[model samples]
Target: MEMEKTTDPTSFHGAYRMTPATFDELLALVGPHIVKQTTNFRDPVGVSERLGITLRYLATDMSQRDVARHFCVGRATVCKIIQEVCQAIWEVGAPLFMAKPTTEDWKKIAEEFNNQWNFPHCLGAVDGKHIHIQKPALSGSLYFNYKRTFSTILMGVADAAYRFIYLDVGSYGREHDGSVFAQSTFGKALEDGTLLLPQSPNGDLPYVFVGDEAFPLKPQLMRPYPGKNLSDKKKIFNYRLSRARRVVENAFGIMVSKWRILRQPIIAKPEKVDKIVKAIGVLHNFMREKEGLEVECDVGSESGMTDVQIRLGANMYSGAAWDIRENFANHFSSPQGSLPYQNDIVQRGLNI
Candidate 1:
């Protein structure tokens, strides 16, 4: 005989795949928005239950069918609940967690970069991730990536601490990182100087985002020198810049680790999967703040110097952007800003 459905929250939370405290905290945050009007003794599945249902699916990579079986709801009901609760979570969580900070906040981030990563005048790090998903019907090769898998792009900016500052998700995976970034609104904002970035401490420097070679170099952006034939100063500069970019790498790792749904190929339509990915991003910040949860990605933080980021060769800009990069590179090798190891590396003539 089949066993009766358990109603105990302690047991439910174990199945929910997060701590009881975190589950309760999440329910309290978004329960009002997702709460259903029709609930009684026979229909005990309320807002909190549906919230738990959705969170369980996210945390465990469980299918909607499995979630429905566990939650004692129909598959259609489960699907509706997931979308509804996800929307609620984004509405309640985005402004608080994903919203851009003030100039003062940016200053703190730059200060952290100076203290921790030894990269000064840095604002944030940018990177792109491919969210794997099943191919949609009648949509031939639209989502096929170079890796021969289907996915959507999740391009994001993270600060020194791996907190997401901006995100643009749901782009077709066929587009390369450079093109995706070029088309992103954040990239446009950076180019247009519409973002209120924190001013340099001494006012002579421009605050900038650190990215891999996948991104084009700009006055407000920094990328390492191309080619294996590099100098010690170039090596040191590359290392310093890579170290700063680790925050975004770690953030993605922690996110995928915690929300295992992203680990496997998500099975859903692109429209629904978009909502799921976005909700995951928002909830990542929520769970991170509430639980102080940060687990590094199993593969470790990537330097992005690999072949994937090395494409879209050699772009020349007709302006001072190139000059600014030269200035930073020169300053990195100068006595005023050069680190001891940097000098040692230069002295040893080692290429990093």
Candidate 2:
């Protein structure tokens, strides 16, 4: 059934859950694709109306049935609109917003890391987020993770600016980050030397991503020193790496704050949840890239290291990867790379 034409455009706050300007601008960008025609029984739903429904669905996290009743459309129509809009967003969105960076892009990102965080030889920060969802019927413990809940993973690589460059969603929550990373194409590319990372800015450092210990170590991926026997140098490296990696955490925060859809356990099917996540992630990058820098979302710590992290230790990567980690560790101690606070903090002598 065609959705009843909204008599008056939904208020900036009521319809799309954002300022009218943002809604108009977003509609202008996407409206051409999602517009529908009015039929005889009902006036065709305008693009903004359909777009409003989708945005409201994401912003309010209201049940589809409720959204339908309020908008005078079938619940199925609401679902269809959501799926369609999300798909539309992904098609145009994924490329412009989340497409893999060019070689020059990577160099600029690396330069930012050096200037901003003093972490050299870094490409991006990588991490996995648990997107909670309803358990499938009679699925036993298949979806259950160590957190004792059903979820899927959102593994992503974030540049220095906290925008997602690559993402993989919908993997079972029961999996650990190490396992998830091992299976992902992104991981395989990074491991096999196909990621086309920029060479060491210093001529000695290989571009790498900073991640928590749950991620596997690779010549291209860096995790902090694990176990309690860390040296002062290791502590400095850990602190610096942790700093660069905070961008991912902030990215998740900003995502949750703006797209309240992700704040709760999503009520849709796992497959639908995947599109919703992708759409939301893509929208976030689009907004950041075009709409300007986001004020960090006050979403607290929804992105804290998950049970997946606690359950898995760092992979014992060897050969080039091991040597690479050592080289970075040494680099962090050098005068050219070391931040002033690293030494005092690593020594536990910095006092408030």
Candidate 3:
């Protein structure tokens, strides 16, 4: 009698096609050392297969069970693989992406802020974005935000080039932007003066950051003038500040777009949520460095604003008009020899 043939249960349906170049590129960003290898006796799937499968899931928004089925592994195995990948990315790639700006880097950023958005002595643009995560099995309300949804806060500081200089994640979803900032390490840095403020090139001005109305009005933080029928100059200043402040929004968009895992409601435990966010951030920076992708800036199209508006907008936003007008009587008057107002002007120029 002829023997019947049995199909291999572990055989993958789709052709396994990944080039060394692709693997090398991924490894360069994520680091080869952190990537786990399969061994004998404890025979497991190939490292490439595991990483590729997990990344495919992240990139495609596939369910973990679906990924497991595609890879011919158990659902638990898929989760393990994802955990490993995330941990690897954090450990090996986090440093490569998140770098504190050096003095020269700060100068370059400041100059760009001055030239582009008319904010000066501004080191970085700061913002908070809500990243939706799966409700934790144990503490669901802890992650609920004002939006009445579960999400973790992603606060970031980006330079003129739109690269993240600092990132903090895993704040409770219910917390407001101010609350998150007040409790964060970066906030502490600011409060304690550990995070150095940019020095004015002229030695008489202080540094400042541009923030939305959501942030408090302070010497270091600026908000747009809240009124209609304002003078052309104040309007121009608002426009310029808005333009510079857009960098943080763009950064958030790029991040969520690249890591589709973040796009999905994260289902991981609350304690591990920080790891997931850090991993995504590390990957973002890694891709930037290893892939040499140009950092995109969204300075509104030239067609949108007239040449006069652009020039005036740039100047007004930079506080040049404020610098010139010291009559303190006219609508455009600024306090004479006032360091705070001067710093505000420089800050407006830098577009923080």
lDDT of 1 by residue, 73-157 (tens): 8999889988888888888888989887778888888888888888888989988888888898887887887878888888988
For this target, which candidate reaches the highest lDDT against the unseen true structure? 2
Off by over 4 Å in 2: 1-18, 201-203, 294-296, 303-307, 310-313, 349-352
lDDT for model 1 comes to 0.76
Cα lDDT tens digits for candidate 3, 1-352? 1111124322221121123444456655554544445566565655666666656666556788888887778899878877787778777766666766666776787778767655656667777777776777777588776656677777877766667778898777776666676688987787787765556654333465665555544445555665666654555456556766777666666666555666667677765667767776776666556544433312322111111001112112335323322111122233432223434554455442
Candidate models: Cα lDDT each = 0.76, 0.77, 0.59
Q: Taking the tens digit of each residue's C-alpha lDDT, what string does model 2 give over 57-93? A: 8877688898888778889888988998898888877
TM-score of each: 0.88, 0.89, 0.73
Q: What is the lDDT of residue 109 in candidate 3?
A: 78
TM-score of 3: 0.73
Supply candidate 3's per-residue lDDT for 262: 66
Higher-scoring candidate on lDDT, 2 or 3: 2
Q: How displaced is residue 10 in candidate 2, in Å?
A: 13
TM-score: which candidate is best? 2
